[model samples]
Each structure stands twice: as C-alpha cells, then as structure tokens.
Target: MSAWEQFITYVSQNGFYIWTEFYRHFLMAAYGVLFASIISIPIGILIARYGKLSGFVMTLGSIIQTIPVLGFMAITMVVMGLGTTTVVVTVFFYSLLPIIQNTYVGIIGVDRTIKEAAYASGMTQFQLLLKVELPLAVSVIMAGIRTALVVGIGVVAIGTFVGAGGLGAIIVRGTNATDGTAIILAGAVPTALMAIVADLIMGKIERMLNPVSN
Candidate 1:
C-alpha cells in the first residue's frame, strides 16, 4: 500500500484512540491559553493604563518565551510530577506573550478622539474602558488569543513527552516502531488539522468583532 493508503488504514483502525488523544490535546492547549488569557489580559490592561510598565512587562514576557519548552516541562514535571497539568503550565507560559502584547496594543490603539468624547460625556475611567475602549479593542485582543491558541496547540504536542496523553504520544509511538511512517502521520495530520481549524475559527471571530468589519 502507498503511504497515504497506509496512513488511512492506520487512522481508520485507531479512530477511537486518535480521537481520545485529540480531545486530550485540545483540552491541554485550550486550558493553558484560557488560564493565560485570564491573567494576561488584565496585566495587559494595567500596563496600558500605566505606560511605564509596558516595557518591563513586554520584557518579562519575552524572557518567558525564551525558555526551552522541554526544559520548562522538565522543571515543572519535577515539581508537579508527570501529568496534563505540567503540559498546561508550559502552554500557559508560552501563550502569555502574544495575548498580553495584542491586548496592550489593542487598548492603546483605541482612538484619542473617542477617549476624549467618552471623558466629556462623564464616563469615568473605568466606564470609558468598559464601554468604549474594550469594545473597540476586542478584535485585536481576540487576534492575540487566536495566535496564542495556535501556538499552544503545537506546544501541547510536546506534552506527550511528560505523559500528558496528547497526539504527541501517538507520534512518539510511531517513532519507536519499525516502518512507522503511517503511524507518525496519523498523529501529524490531526495536529495540523487542529491548528488549522483553530486558526480559521478564531480568525473569523476576530474579524467579525472588528468594528471596521461591521
């Protein structure tokens, strides 16, 4: 059989297992990015509110981004032990830079005219941010989230190394087997599809939220 045929056979034979890993992988990535967003968005807003902190915050995010994924996982695994949690933590840190950067850019990108008008209309600082700035900036913030999620999906694949039960484990299994090209592809194809689907869905949402699009 051709490589493609073999890949199809492998996928068909292990559909349930593949799907289980896919679900696990998706959860690990999603949870990581979700947690990161909860924290990073607020941090992004604070730094935007106080410009003095932007540079420092950006620099800190950059430093975290520089950490080797495997090394980070190893460190976390030692502390947390082998599990999905370790992978989620790694994905969370990896997700921080894009979300925070986009959020900061989005908030500051709100128009000066609008801000003044909001202030003139008796909107308090909090109200202005809530009512005007955030609405306008939402698309950009979503763009950051989209980027983080796409990256997080890839990061979660490495979780298999820590026994996190992601598609990466499937790929690894193939690698450990003889004549495992199809097996490797069984995992690779789904990972690619997940990233592509996530990007398309989130990209659509980001565009739809843009006031420019509306």
Candidate 2:
C-alpha cells in the first residue's frame, strides 16, 4: 500500500490515541503561555513605567531566546526531571520574549497627548492605566500573546525529548519503526493542522481587539 493508505489505516485504528496526544500537546503549549502571561504582562507594565528598566529586561528576554532549544531543555530537565512538567517549564522560558517585548511596545506606544489628557482630567496614574492606557494597548498586548502562542505550539513538539507526550511522541515512535513514513505523517499532519487552527483563531481575536478595527 502507498504511504497515504497506511497513514489513513493507522489513524483510523488509533483515533483515540491520536486525540489524546493532540489534547496533551495543546495543554502543554497553552499552560506554558498562560503561566508566562501572568508574570510577563506585569513585568512588561513595570518596564513600561520605568524606561531605563526596559533595556535590561528586554536584553534578558533576548538572551533567553538565544539559547538553543535542546540545550535549554536539557538545563530545565536537570532541575525538573522528565515528563510533562519539564516540557511545560521549557515552554515557559521559550515563550517570554515575544509577550514581554510586545507588551512593552504597546504600552509605550500609547499617545502622549492622550495620557496628558487623562492627567488633566484628574485621573491617578493607576486609574489612567486601567481606564485609558490599558484599553488602548490591549490589542497590541493580544498581538504579543498571539505570537507567543503560535511559537509555543511549535516548541511543545520538542517536549517529546523529555518524555512529555504529545503528537511528538507519535512521530518519535514512528522513527523507530520499519516503513514508518505513514506513522510520521499521522503525527505530523495533526500538528500542522493544530498550529494552523490556533493561529487563525488568535489572529481573528487580535484583530477584533485592535482599537482601529472598523
């Protein structure tokens, strides 16, 4: 049989297994980004308030990004050991740069005149952030999340290396089998589709949040 026929056969036989792996893969990516967002968003807001700190924080995030994926995963694994926990931690580290950078840019990009107007209207700094700046900046912040999530989805595939199951696990299994091209496709096709679906959904949400959207 051709590879396509084999792929369909494998998928039909293991539909439940594939679905479980797909769900696991998505949860790893989502959790990693979710945890990062809780911290990075606050850090971004702080650095935006302190212009001098922006340079240092951004530099730190960039430095993290520069680390090779396998190398970074090894480092995290040493501390956390194998399985999904390590992968989630690795994903968190990998996801920081885009979210932090975007949040900083979005906050600072708010118009100076609008900020001034808020002050004139007797708004406290915190009130201004809540009522003025954040509302305007949310779209750009969402853009950061959009970027982080897409990248995170890709990164989670590497989680298989640490014994964290995902679609990657299926691909790895196929690599050891004779005539495993179909098995590899069974894993790979879902991963690509998952990423594409995620990107499309996030893109729509980002555009909706954009203040200038008609």
Which candidate leads the pack in lDDT? 1
lDDT of 2 at 172: 91
Question: Worst 10-residue stretch by lDDT in candidate 1?
Answer: 63-72
| Segments of candidate 1 deviating more than 4 angstroms | none
lDDT of 2 by residue, 1-214 (tens): 9999999999999999999999999999999999999989889999999999989998999999999887888899999999998888888988888889888888999999999999999999999999988888888888888888888888888889999989999999999998899989989999999999988998898889888894
lDDT by residue (tens digit), candidate 1, 1-214? 9989999999999999999999999999999999999999999999999999999999999998888899999999999999999999999999999999999999999989999999999999999989999999999999999999999999999998999989999999999999899999999999999999999999999999999989
Top-TM-score structure, candidate number: 1
lDDT of 2 at 84: 92
Candidate 2 deviant stretches above 4 angstroms? none
